[model samples]
Target chain A: MINPHDSVIVRTMSRMLIPLIQLFALYVLFFGQYGPGGGFVGGVMLGTSLILGILVYGRDGVPCRAARKLMHGDGVGLIIFAGVGGICLVMGGQFLNYSSLEIPLADDARRRYLGILMTQIGVAVDIAVTAISIVFSLSPINDTEDTEPSRD
Target chain B: MIFSFEIPLLILLLLTAAGAIIVKDLISAVLILGSYSFVLALVWAWLGAVDVAFVEAVVGAGLATVFFLLTLFNASPKDTEIRRQPVPFIAFLGLPMLGLLLLFAAEDLPEFSDPKSPASVHVSPEYLEQSYQKTDTENVVTSVLMDYRGFDTLIETAVIFTAGIACALLLRRDSK
Candidate 1:
């Protein structure tokens, strides 16, 4: 959906900003234990970056294929979350009993940390995919018939 | 109460809310609503509810505003005139009754951050005391959300997933 008539300033600025936004989102997701950020906020930021990309570059501006995959992979996060909980249950603890995890960590507390981190990652993935998918779904598709061919 | 600062903030919030309702243009109303959310977030943060404030800032002021703008763009651009509807009898009479009941109930609530408060004396203290030792997480909010209340979070995630899917199904034009 690239248009030759699109402004150069927006395209250039967004290209630079999008990567920084995604990086910050990742930092928030991983560093949530000691900070104010978490998976939900990080995921929203990531989704906002993708939405900005779409606004600047159009539907095809962001990686369209990856976006489609993310849309379908929305369930992946929940699966991971539930899977971890199920594993804990099978290991003779209650559901989501992270202390029951048989990780290589030195103690139960460490294992709990690992479990929480894993769960946060799952939440981040789910939220990010959902946000992007919602934006993609709601965005108006470009009319191919009326649009002129790309000049590039 | 932090009344010195809170009074002004509450006034500003009221103004923004009123402005949002009174504004004729839909876009203008949305912008005002965003401002209202921001003010509300600030008030929440001032009251030491940082997590709630963060969610309000992100979801209310950020994502919700963006979604509203997107929906606005999809619809025909029109200056929406606010039409005054007749106030229902229940709203006029029952609302005041409800408000009075709430005010009466508020008398029994523990003082703000009172050590002897039911909330402080109950499971909250245990959660605070044990969270770090049990979960190895310094942030009590994180420990509580991801560990103690994981089932609720899982359900919340499922709801969000369902919303995304529903939006996609309803909006996407089928490519034949």
Candidate 2:
């Protein structure tokens, strides 16, 4: 009862929404400073877009190269978070104290504030990548029972 | 900002939370719980804690619901009618007692957004004043999350990773 052409239309519509969702997510990420949005919101948007891409265009629609790169984004995000702290430790300040960074700032307090926001970004990216990976792994919708026979 | 809850939004939030609790179907419960989380996020937004609201919307509403749905499919959809046990009541009461203690302690908290509250007067002030200049990042929430509390943030990342792994292990099909 479903027409092939109609399916194409549906897919196209779905595809069209991806860019809009992406833009909205970015807006949330940047606007969190002044309004109601932040890294977590932005990450969800990014993850949803990828999932939407898979839904509308199927697996092939997801860019293979991007997937490969993003697969490591979680680890990279963790490294960024830890690396920031490690730098503070080496500088003989409290772990994660950005004021200790040997940067020329009028106030060390300013540097510390910047450090915190940078870390939040890393957390957001980590969340997004991990979420995407999980979605991808579980999305085939195949039942586990198919892989084995129950004797009971 | 209007502090009192609007009738419609309150009704919607109550309905969503109730639906999450009362839904007979697992998938329906997951969906309704997601709605409840979104409502909570809206509540946070109204309170002007955009950072908290964003995290709740994404993690609590989005990924958590996804995780629940995936687990839902892993098990049978049939609802089991197990009679409620009374043992949980003790723990439940203990939780509210703890909450009450915290609430009493909060009497000392700077009233809501009072500029003089310890939270408002402490390190947060520095971040508000200097984050943009030092991080060159427009978003203060982003700067704070990534740079100032980066160590704790990494631990939180590990928690998420661990949760994902735990879910996967529990949901994965066991091999003979």
Candidate 3:
């Protein structure tokens, strides 16, 4: 079982840093349209932050429930992306044709922008979940150690 | 491109790559490999590929190092121990031959960042020009991936999801 790092400074700093990293990840995800950030990078950063939490505090930083929920997020993201494509297909246009969605979008450009946003969100969710689950699978044996009874 | 900055980054990249391979300890090798990824990311950023650089920095430098370290946790000391053995004859012959082949191929590649290169002269410029107007996104790469080529991203997501599941299945198979 992998134990959390024992250094006080390491744990203290990770506690302070994880939230900031997650915030930056969200910024990268949402502001991707206007900047160098994008779904893939943003998602990677989000996963890295969670991994950092896991490295420093083990299961305390990320509860088992939360991790399991995120494991399912892998499929949720795929469903979201495919469902958006299906919506466009049902709207009487080619699959993933953003402009075909007959919504209350102000313009065709706006429709495209919404499509970009949704697709980016879906990609971000998928990548982040994959990264998290891979790490989780590697370290889950470690997390269960805390629950075991210790012998004197 | 700032030759002053680029030169050092390239040198550091080469040094890190060499150091990583030459290191005796697996942990040190992994750390050096992370630095190599970091320097490569900087080189990509210098070349004006910000999105690529971001992915390289986060995935290559940060997450990959962690993943390697975690994987190492499952490894035993016997697996990590190095044994002195005679170099294989095929490695002696094939390594240099492969290096020569790669060098020969590299010579024919286009010069770095040549605006008139075949890739630049192709449909790339149109994507850059029309991305903002069509998708209302300033980042052309994002628009290209998510808007123009959505199915490719979908497939990519599927692949990543599958990889995660496969990793979980392979690793957890014996535990339960």
TM-score of each: 0.88, 0.69, 0.90
**Weakest 10 consecutive residues, lDDT, candidate 2 chain A?**
A1-10
The candidate that wins on TM-score is 3
- The residue-by-residue lDDT of candidate 2 on B1-176, one tens digit each, is 35456565678899998887766666787898898899888888877876787778877887788767755554554543334455676888898999999999988766777898777787988998987777655667666766655556678888876665554455434423
Instruction: Predict model 1's lDDT versus the native.
Output: 0.81
> Which candidate's DockQ is highest?
3
lDDT for each residue of candidate 2 in A56-110, tens digit (9 for 90 to 100)? 5544445333653686665565676677778878988878877786667436656
Of candidates 2 and 1, the better by lDDT: 1
Q: Give all candidate RMSDs, comma-separated.
A: 4.0, 5.8, 3.0
Please give the lDDT score at residue B130 for candidate 1: 93
Native contact fraction of candidate 3?
A: 0.84
Top-down TM-score ranking: 3, 1, 2
Residue B73's lDDT within candidate 1 is: 75
